[model samples]
Target: MNNVMGIALSGMRVAQQGVQVAAHNVANLATPDAQRLQLKRSAVEQGGVQASVTPAGVDAAAQLGDLLAAKAEVVAFAANATVIRRQDQMLGSLLDREA
Candidate 1:
């Protein structure tokens, strides 16, 4: 329950970070000195995942692809959250029935 929610929340956080990085890359397209950034995610030792920002090159096609990927990540995060909500609801219903 808590573990599942934690994983979903971590995924949402990473997705948000990805979206921010993509938007930043798109916004700074014209800045010559700007260093394109990317969000990297890694699984934590305890559970969930964590995100980090790393330097990336400014390539138009790659940036576009990153935007699309971020969009997909958002959708995935939403789905994960939904699963957690549904699981929580089911647990509540079960507890109510038991009571």
Candidate 2:
């Protein structure tokens, strides 16, 4: 149960970082020689994922895709949050019954 929460929290954090990087790329679309950013993610050994920002090439189509992906990441973030909330509720109910 606790592990589930940790996994969900990590997922939410990754999604958030993804959105931030996407936003940065989209925001710099019009600037000259703006360094596009990309979010790289890797699974953690314990349980969860880690994200890092990296430089990327500038492409209009790719930037648009990133915006779309950012929208999806927002949804993913919300889903992870829901999982955490549900887990908390379940734990509370279990404790209540035990008490």
In order, what is each prediction's RMSD in angstroms? 1.6, 1.1
Error of 1 at 80 (Å): 2.1
Deviating ranges (above 4 Å) for candidate 2: none
Mind giving the per-residue lDDT tens digits that candidate 1 earns over 29-48?
A: 78889888888789988688
Best candidate, lDDT: 2
Error of 1 at 99 (Å): 1.3
Each prediction's TM-score versus the true structure: 0.86, 0.93
Compared with the true structure, model 2 gives a TM-score of: 0.93
Clashing pairs in 1: none
For each candidate, the alpha-carbon lDDT, in order, equals 0.83, 0.90
lDDT, candidate 2, 40-89, per-residue tens = 89999989898999998656588679889899999999999999999999
